[model samples]
Target: MTAPASSAPPLPDPAPYQGAPERHPRRPRHPLDTATDPEAVELTAPVFGPADVDALDADLTRQHSGEPLGERLTVTGRVLDRAGRPVRGQLVEIWQANASGRYAHRRDRNPAPLDPHFTGVGRCLTDGDGRYAFTTVKPGAYPLPGAGAWRPAHIHFSFFGTALTQRLVTQMYFPGDPLLPYDPVLAAVPDPAARRRLIAAYDHQLSLAGGALGYRWDVVLGGPAATWAEEGRR
Candidate 1:
């Protein structure tokens, strides 16, 4: 006679825990890769605090008086890892002044025409391929906050991904900004080479099927060594 067989308990399904404990899948590289590299100086510290999300969103979504925010200029870009793989579903927020170089905020004090219909805030979410797009007017050149009072035309960008601790804050400069030399903030970026990387290139040929000036700017984030190694193959 065959020996009696014992019944064993069923194994727990892992589907529920798949992405629970781990970071978001959008970032292909590990957090270690982004933190250990000497090249990632600016990325070392978390720029935004946990308490900042609400305030940030409020600022980003508020409506401001401005010239009918010029018909939307489509801004498109990608978010990638140090290894250059697309980082999907990252949150991207953008803000800029109206064509008159005046912000909708009361603090702007530029006295320029405020289009009651136009506000500078916009948001976008990266797709699976790490691509993102949003519509906004091209910000005009404005005076910076200082004795020199000079600033180039630019846009502010904020980003967040699966890793809450790795939020980034940066500015995008338009090409051929004559005042770049006079801008203290732009000059403050430590690495001359990395500083140049922040300036966006203008492309007239990127017009949509309808002939809109499309701007493209990509963002690269640092990650763990293991993530960097994995990203290196591609």
Candidate 2:
């Protein structure tokens, strides 16, 4: 005799196989594992209008009634991206010690005389061609607190995009500075080529008639030849 099929609602469709739970859930990875990584964290751009920056802000020497004590300098440069394209309309700021190697800050106990007329700070926006210039004095080398070696004569540069988080800080050194060899901060950069990029070149074309000496330094935001940032690559 043939056996009849059991009904039992067709065995409940085999209970839809449930796979095992992930033994080790994969950890999230950062966008920038390496410099070449294509992924990047998007940052909001800062908003700045013409009224935000005063025309006089670009001239540090004229901030006070009298001129600051130091060798007058006309520092000019273009801000560029990795592709060598101009980064127009960005804000560039600079602050440094006076010619005597003394900072205007209260905590700076370098013992050097401070120039009453010099505030040692300036800022300007990049032009359409990405060029920005400042009229100021060359900063003097200052000794690091408790450290035997002295810091090289360099101007502290701060570049800002749309936001404060987009700010990139670095120091610009003059060419042929003897202190360059001993500056621990500059030495922290492992690459020789990258260190050289920090030094500005003398530009006679940009020099003032008999006033400030001119220097040209172009900042590269990223790429193989990008400028060496103080905090590291951004």
lDDT of 2 at 183: 74
lDDT of each: 0.62, 0.81
Model 1 TM-score on a 0 to 1 scale: 0.63
Task: List per-candidate RMSD values in Å.
Answer: 21.8, 23.1
Instruction: In model 2, state the lDDT of residue 166.
Output: 79
Model 1: how far residue 168 lies from native, Å? 0.7
Q: Can you give the lDDT of residue 99 in candidate 1? A: 77
Top lDDT hit? 2
TM-score per candidate, chains pooled? 0.63, 0.78
Cα lDDT tens digits, model 2, 164-192, are: 55788888999978777777777766777
TM-score of 2: 0.78
